[model samples]
Target chain A: MSDLQIKDAVKSYGNVDVLHNINLDIESGEFVVLVGPSGCGKSTLLRMISGLEDISGGEMFIDGELVNDVDAAKRGIAMVFQSYALFPHMTVAENMGFSLKLAKAHKSEINEKVRRAAEILQLEKLLERKPSQLSGGQKQRVAIGRAIVRNPKVFLFDEPLSNLDAELRIEMRAELIQLHKQLKTTMIYVTHDQVEAMTLADKMVVLEGGQVQQVGKPLELYDDPSNMFVAGFVGTPRMNFLPAEVVDVSNTTSTLRFAAENGAPEVVLPMTDGKLAIGSKVSVGIRPDHLHFSPAQSGDLAIPIDVAFVEELGDLTYVYVDTKAGTRLSSQKKDGRHNHGTTGYAVADTTSMFIFDADGHRVRA
Target chain B: MTDAIASPSALASNRRKIKVPSLWTVLKWIAAISVAVVALFPLWWMFSVVFAEAGVPVAVNPRLYPTSFTDGFAKIWEVFEETGYLRAYYVSIMYTILTIAGVLLISSMAAFEFALFDFPGKNALFAVVMLSLMVPLAVTLIPTYLLVAQLGWVNTMQGLVVPGLASAFGLFMMTQFMQSIPKETLEAGRLEGANHFQLYWYIALPLSKNALITLAILTFMKTWGNFIWPLVVSNTREVYTVSQVINQFNSPFSHTTVDVVMTANFLAAIPPILFFVFFQRWIIEGVQMSGSKG
Candidate 1:
């Protein structure tokens, strides 16, 4: 395994810049995921690292050597495309062994490497099958097997699981994690699915519009996002942003207020400093799980509400409350939970709420 | 129960009433056979003329069958020995094969380049190629003859084969077919460490077998019957194509030996007809499929 470093990487088509000033250092054996929405230039960045795309302005170092001008064949990197681009005419084994053949490796060595990769991917039975004959999951495995047979220092995957069905996507995700553990090669994966990024990556880079929003472990990003985009983008059901005004600020906490049309409780968040003066505006952030329903005496103030809806998934139930603050918000709780009241605990006992100013930057406490 | 039974019976009667077009079926067959006969009349007449005797009267009244064969196949063989017919056949065959080989090589390379790579002046170059398609081959006749003469290639097979090696139709057809191959396939091959030559040889070329075969068949046929360029360039009788020789069998004011000439003409048609029969499927099915897919 070899570390990869990219410094001041920029990609542009004529005047329109697609990726701007991207800088990252990935350690050897690290599984880093570049996750963002479509057109975020994450795939372009991965292609650049693979040397499939020309680097417009940047220095890229692989194993302590600059490789920006290297040809894709000389870069010693293998990629698994989202389309599972197995040569439709070649059988699975031939597809896996194609790179070795191109390198003029010994035929025996090529066969041994291909067999090993097939074993690792559980594709021994599929050696004679063409891509058109295989299921989507099987085709994906062959694509990965082809990459593994190259035995490159770095492995790149461009949304390899995006084409599989939901159940197969989860299965492949687990298998990929296991594959990484066994191979321990430096891997850079690009995907628009946040769930895949959170589950598979040791270090996740959330990009938006060609810029990195946040780079950290999954939970660190969930707990402390650098900005509102990262906060809203990194979570499921998304972190609810309630527009509030700071009513009063003390040494340790601030009382916040939002119009409670359905008799909902006042929005209150704890603050470590008096950054916002009285009557100043701010936004309060809270996770749905952070807000749970219990007896009115056990938690914060309660207000009457007409139940909007409920969703139960065996272990937990989601309560949709209007709060009558113009838009509705959801709270997750144990099943058989009914609060006839709108108020619930803010997140949890251990989870602290987030606050952001008007510019969508996190208000540092 | 009676109501349900009556409903199904009534539905059956309604279906039978809707099926009132058996007369259309009979008319359809009549129309189809009439069209087939009309299309085949020229071929039937060619056969009738080939077998008719030299002295027998083939009337304008149109006898449906042959009367006799005084010249028979012997006269075609005599023509084969007497005139430039044998050399014409050989020249046409050689030119067709050579043209097919050149078109396959040059046009496929152009197609792969246009389909895969992005370079400066690519669109302009491709536009030039498409512009060649729009320009009729006849417009370039004088210039091409002058260039061939300057190159000292007149009356040589090189004069016939080299000028139109990279056929615009072949390039256009192949480029369109190659473009239909997803970009991911090429990128995957690149990531597999295949160089440009290897990608072309092992991936693009193999994947484009249908289009290549189609272009080969069409190019061979076009060159086999090519008269204008061959007639202009090949001043020697030894270098004439079948089309030129077939024209030589004609005389405007004299009594042309019609049966002997027709037999010779029929024999002349055999090579291309055999070629078409052997390879028509590839062009009709494979090329059309590739073009539509692109």
Candidate 2:
């Protein structure tokens, strides 16, 4: 029953508000990731949940108890910082057993718990070594071991993988998933890396400008985003947005006309309840993978583009093209072709397209 | 033919490069030797006077080296017997040890607070502390002595040790060093249920070992050689430090010989010299750390 809830939480410094009206819930054993770009208040919200930062307004509950004023140590939560803040003078065993030692637990009990955590983290061989003697990956493992020894009701991770190298980050990402399955504590992790969020989170939260843009399962946000911000932020290389004008509206479909310089393309998308008036400006959003270099099919929209550059990433290549309207778009290709300086047609699947009005709000049919 | 001709010139150039030092290198050596001679000349003169033959008239015919070890040592024994030199040594050692302990503990704790925590008047209070450094010590000496006298501690160890414990330079140095410790480390301690004092003791204190050693050495050297405060406070023979006793020999009323006076000065200087010799590395390291951080 180690559920956590944050109700309308606000964080401010003097009069400048940094986090505005954040509300979230975490059930037992669920992995939630709060992700956004730098300064998006994701780290601030995590600090508030960990009780390191004070909540300027609203309530926080852990295990059904309001904990707005509780001390950070008494909140029954452990955090693994991005810096892996292991005491440099203490050995691995001593660091893992620090909280227990502070609690005045007996020597044998502390030793046993530390030993167990070391075994779990595969740190038994390095128990006698200091942090300065360990590698970056080992130090991160010891930090996790320290948290595991506490057996807190919840775990907070603030971009813990940001310090590791690319190969080691992938390795530790897998280890974190395994640790979550083994421990089954309610974990709230924060990061700005969408690939990490997509792979590790049971529920992903997208935040921008101190506000949560959307919160849902990773694929749900990817497949059916609630707003243009969520659609653009959730995927790698970003989704392509093209400006268009609504030309006509029927009972079941709406026709949009792109600029004449872009092959004068017209796309008629399915709409059950059309509320858009003619001559209204809108942007059509499509993921990079949904755009293909082949010719258009029955219901696809085709637009001419100049291939600006191609990035060949072994198994997959990314094609960055410039449309005639001076819009730069990226499309993922699996053929690993080098099509630089070649003008080509990009066919966009209309079924997977997203439509947004001038204010960046989704217009669902 | 061109290769053979070029080889000899290249060889000659390489030989000249190896044999001739740069003008900058020559100037650096000259400057270093000049400073060394200026610093060491006084020490050599002191030793030359200490070991000169009795009634040798060293001022008229100064010897660069010792004339006789036996006369110098015999004079030292006589001075020790006549002037309570051993008791002065004990008193000076105790004063230096106690003052060093007090200064390190007080200043390091002050530094931890000033560097790590935030309070209502944090910046203003630190500004005041920094301002205290600007006021000359001579200005405070009379007032401080008057306060000590009013407390009826003119000849007490507390008067000697307590008044000098709040070192502005030490607090400033230590605060700079402590600020370099990552705040995340202290926050980790906070999350582990450690209080402020525990954090200071277990975390901050251990991390500040180099700065502490550096401060201790500086305090040790300063307190060991202090003469003015003891002269102002200790009018009795029992509380006299080595520096006071050394000054007593050079006083106008005393008839102590030059060799005996120089012997006392030489003995009083050995502890500081040995201390500097032993811990010079930490002082350099601590200074570099403080420099970069500050």
Candidate 3:
């Protein structure tokens, strides 16, 4: 019952606009993640929805009620801060029961609600300990417990697990997903971590410079990005962009030549709708995971590369490569492409590559 | 090991690296103790005078110590018995407690706003509070007295306590101390459906237990030992505070007795001393706990 609709929402400090025309409709029980790099306005958008930050313009509705002018508490939203924001003086049970007590609930009712949340969080044993006595992971659980007791319409988490260590962060991330499923409530989580956005979100909104770049499911954004920024930001180890020039165009296909070492010929790519004109400067994008070592030195489709470094992460190896013309790119070195030397590694794969115009808008290949 | 291998002079000069005191260090301790003793000699002299007989000849040097040690105790008991000095003691304690309670309420509440909230002219208003700290009480004595008289509270406890409550110094200390507390904690309180007052009462107050204790100590000591305000505000002996009534030993209506005044001074010093000893743990525990806060 906690669906949220934000219409033409804008946020600014004086004349300096920080978030521009943000429009989103979140369905009930959906886990939506607003994610971007630092200063990209994800936190601001979350704060606005939580009613912590005032919306400079436009409307916000939560649970079919216009909440733009409502106080944070009355808006039926609970926010978990990055710092956890647990009351240090109160024990775990008291912290969990604060909202209920403030609502003037009876002592027994408060205790029952607190006990329920503690049991769910597995914090029953630590109920008597203060926030300072708890470990980092334990503190975060208590923070979530505090939020759970309220049973707010929407749960707003502002990088709640960013403070945890990497291993703990992974563990907490999985737990948060499970918690959302168990509660069957709408949750809006904000983070700059793409991995968090990809893994935890049912739908991900990628933002950059205070504007919505793209929004889709995790793999949808990964497989088919709307623009160059979305393509570069959504994937891990990122997609590579190389300077490309259109050579010859016919009815349905265009021959494209990319910047490469001397004597590399052009490659053929199928084009639709005649979107790219001949001699137009464009950028070619290749995903690291999508790339394979193309069959041995086929044509100009293969660029001569010198290996800069190799990062082996268990199941996959990422080879950092720089073409001889100084165009840098990374390729997934699968199927024994482990040639590391001064000799140029001629590599190319046209099976799954992207093309973007000079304006950074993607033209489907 | 690196510290042990360091040069002798370097190690001696460095506080962290220093192992033991050298010849120079022993001399420094002796010098510091000498300065402290010289500074405390006046208090010792006052205590000594409390023991000497009350009616000793004015021209002669008083006996260093009376024949009976109970002379000071006996004289102190007589002052309470004969004079209204005991009532003065009661009045002082009552008003000092009231004044501190009022000041803590007003200052901590106001400071919470200044530290956490945003509003128009916030800095300008805060600057005015800061500026009041620089204006000495002496400068406002006449106008303040006139206002107290106008209110017809000249010799009442309210006039005495109310005028001195809400000090800029206390407000500034509270604001700065509360500012050091992370804003996220209070914001959490807000999300818990707590309004500004509840946030102050529940989150700010509990988090600032040390600061409140420290401020309470300062306020209690200041109002307890205050002289001029009480003297000017109250002329009736019934309303006389400890500091004001002690002047009566100089013989306002009759014979002067330095011994009883010294005894009063000695008794006055006791409460503050006990107060410090009781709450010194808070004063010593550096204002706050460290990083473990969520």
| Highest DockQ against the true fold, candidate | 1
Minimal lDDT window, size 10, model 1 chain A: A342-351
How far in Å is the alpha carbon of B159 misplaced in model 1? 0.3
Per-residue accuracy of model 3 over B124-204 as CA lDDT, tens digit each: 999998998789888999999999999999999998999888788778888888898798898888888999889999999
lDDT of each prediction vs. the true structure? 0.82, 0.88, 0.84
The CA lDDT at B37 in model 1 is 98
Give the per-residue lDDT of model 2 (tens digit) for B178-231.
Answer: 998999999888888888898999899999988898888778877987888888
Which candidate would rank higher by TM-score, 2 or 3? 2
User: A80-158, model 2: which lDDT tens digit per residue?
Assistant: 9999999998999999999999999999999999999998899999999999999999999999999999998999999
**On lDDT, who's better, 2 or 3?**
2
The Cα error of candidate 1 at residue B118, in Å, is 2.3
- Chain B TM-scores, listed for every candidate in order, come to 0.85, 0.89, 0.82
* DockQ for each numbered candidate: 0.75, 0.70, 0.73
Docking class of 3: medium
Instruction: Rank candidates by lDDT, best first.
Output: 2, 3, 1
Instruction: Give the true-contact fraction for every prediction, in order.
Output: 0.92, 0.66, 0.84
Kindly provide the TM-score of model 2 when superposed on the true structure, using C-alpha atoms.
0.92
